[model samples]
Target: MVERVTLITGAAAGIGVELARVFSSNGHRLALVDRRGDRLTTLASEIVAAGGTAPILICCDLEHPEACDDIAAALAVEGVEVEFVVNNAGFGLFGYATELDRAEQLGILAVNIVALTDLSLRFSESMIRHRGGILNLGSLAGFLPGPGMAVYYASKAYVLSFSEALRQELAPLGVRVTALCPGSVSSEFQARAGIEPGLEHEILNVSASDVAYAGYRGLMQNKRVVLPGLGIKIVPLLLRLFPRGFILAAIGRIQLRKRR
Candidate 1:
């Protein structure tokens, strides 16, 4: 049985919940964090019914600037020692930067860039001492500029950049940092990102569980970066081969559909 704790942000649903399940299966004790306490409780119950340990639920809106500090304080108070921190909680806006609500775009940066960065730094200090690992969720969108989801794409680009730098810094200390870049997954992300109800991304969508499993494997293998789906893995290469103008135009048209 794994005695080390793995704390996962956004553990109430989608890839976060899937991450929780995957980590739990490996016998890691989980501290599941999300804004939705009730949903987390429900998920905990299900996991318990399946003979897993009841996860400790941490309910906090990660949008608040101090959220990561607050969670760290709470864990300290609980005497919880985390072996892994999965920064998986994030959302995007599906519109032109000028057209989308300014607050919404900032909120995307808040959770995606700020909170994830804060948690990774704060937790990695301890992880380094213990020779543990961190897994950050990036996106295929991070490899290219996104016209419709400008802030979201930029935020993930930061994640990809940050994770790589941090990984190198932590490498000598025996602390692993893995960035999981996945293409679109069939999840609440589309609705939450304000994608159109009629928009279809079936061809690009991968399963959350698949991505979660790949993330888990990558983290265990001490891989620096993991592209979970075939489409996601091919994207960066394609980006390099295509002319910037052509790629941007194609992306613009695809993203424009979400705005309609």
Candidate 2:
């Protein structure tokens, strides 16, 4: 039997790295992609040292438009047939929209929205042909308005909606799709987002390992959406049930408190 290859973006650390560990432990060959080449190389070495196969480390920034094509071409050259693709490369920004730099906002969109969506489409086409799987990392913030982190929240919302629709469209082709929605997670996300560290501790936070495990399980089950934390599981449903105005007001209040 041919060894299965799983391509995971942002695989140098956080949830992405945990997902790589999970797949590697299960005997799948990995193609770990991340912008942090040094970290990716260290992780690959550790995996190999631990007796699991070391992954192919692709250290290219996915935020660029040409990244998807470049990765696809590189994989072809390496003779790695991707049986699974996890679009997990993302970051968050926190601040009032007006206070944020336009270029920074656009950069966030390029990585969190454009890259993810384009990669999913490009990889899904191949997956459909091979009857493989795709897992997208969304966020609990996707369910409702996030006042300070507007663009990041909106990007995640797109991910959730896109993953669900794609799952439906690809069902007949045996190409499974899953969207993993996680709330506050113990990672460098808070620092990267410029979120107050104190605020993170106040919320129900799950470990990256927990999020990765749940995401992998849900992906294997072909679930359309998977919320990692129990407290966050009801957020999507509640957002759908409540009025949008009410949700916005609540989020605004929370943001105001955080800014204080």
**In candidate 1, what are the lDDT values of residues 1-260, reduced to their tens digit?**
32467889999999998999999988888889999989999999988988898787888999998888888887877777778999999999887899889998899999999999889988776787678899999988888889988999999999999999999998999989999998878888988887854433555577999999999999999998999876667777878888999998998988776666
Clashes of 2: 0
Which lDDT tens digits does candidate 2 get at residues 23-110? 8887878999998999999999988997898788788997777887888887887776778989999998889989998788888899
C-alpha lDDT score of every prediction, in listed order: 0.87, 0.86
Error at 172, model 2, angstroms = 0.4
> Model 1 reaches what TM-score against the true structure?
0.95
Q: Which stretches of candidate 2 lie over 4 Å from their true place?
A: 1-3, 197-201
Candidate 1 stretches greater than 4 Å from native: 1-3, 197-200
TM per candidate? 0.95, 0.94
